[model samples]
Target: MDFSDLNEALASESYDQIGEICDNLMLQAASEGVPFQDEWPYAVHLLGHIYVNDINSARFLWKKIPSGLKSSQPEISAAWKICQKLWTKDYGGVHESLREFDWSSQSQGIIIAFSERYRKRMFELLVSAYSTISIRDATVFLGMNEDDAINYAAVGGWTVEPNSGMLTVKKAAVAVEQKVDPGKLQRLTEYVFHLEH
Candidate 1:
């Protein structure tokens, strides 16, 4: 139950150990009557924002939020500021170009090229930023060990499975029957329990 111990466990990078640690942590939090369900929505929102390259805007808005107002009021003003900045910096010329140029006519003339490599790199950056907290402190906050926290993150589409030698939750889910497969549950349970011992 020690936060310091949990932090140490997470730093080890062993997925199984992490999962076990998170499972116990979650159980402990529940025993203390902490309401994790309430936090789930925010977590999902964070995931989506990260997936879509919105982390920078989110961070900018976070910084603009007044210390007192931030906690007491909604962050709509901060979000507005971020939107204004993004529009001015990135999309400012787009409207004018579209108006003056034959952008619409030319758009379909050739493939507007984009790099899969670049997109993947951007996704990695977003995932790295998202993992900074969720893969560590947020997991601790949620009372999960490293592995369970990582698993939950994967389930939420934050991380990709290894190219080989790992049974990803998605793969396991697809291989099973019923709403929640008992076999997969057992596998996860055994995995966590083994790490604890």
Candidate 2:
């Protein structure tokens, strides 16, 4: 991976671009039979997962990380804790860490990658908390201003009652059945999702 470009992308918050770069690197690494001798690549892969809020993929990557590297790299350990906290619903702790993590600590990219993940969590909480909610209340819950809240409702295709700042969350679609994972060990991990795509 090109540290210069990667760092610039992190600073720019170009998450999709970061995902593309990291995914390509991973494909190349795999093609060359690269082993997990260090934490840098895994950290980049984890950052990509954070970019898209794919905790399942993140756990898969974390699982594949060799134990030596996981404990050896402070950044790797720290990033895994962020994932673990999110997985376990420790939002307050994750938020606190995110707030303090910065470039000066030498992990700004890892820090910022989770902003999207946290926002996604907020959206999920809003939807799951109630079948419907007032736009004003949603704004408070989502930390959005009124106009932005309205725009958000519109963008989500939510039903907004005329002249009432209320947004209704329709029953979201879900899989008819959950797939089973063949790997017993991975299936047993609490942080890992067992269902296949």
- Model 1, 82: alpha-carbon shift in Å? 29
Candidate 2 on 126-149: residue-level lDDT in tens? 777778888877775555577887
lDDT over C-alpha atoms for residue 9 of model 2: 70
Off by over 4 Å in 1: 36-197
Task: Report the C-alpha lDDT of model 1 over 56-150, residue by residue, as the tens digit.
Answer: 64454345344555445333332333234334543322222222332222121111111122233433444444433434443333334558656
What is candidate 1's local distance difference test score? Answer: 0.39
| lDDT score for candidate 2 against the true structure | 0.66
For each candidate in turn, the TM-score is 0.19, 0.52
Q: Pairing residues by index, what is the TM-score of model 2?
A: 0.52
Global fold similarity of model 1 (TM-score): 0.19
Q: lDDT values of the candidates? A: 0.39, 0.66
How many steric overlaps does candidate 2 have?
Answer: 1
> Which regions in candidate 2 have their CA more than 4 angstroms from the true location?
1-8, 34-36, 99-106, 116-124, 127-197
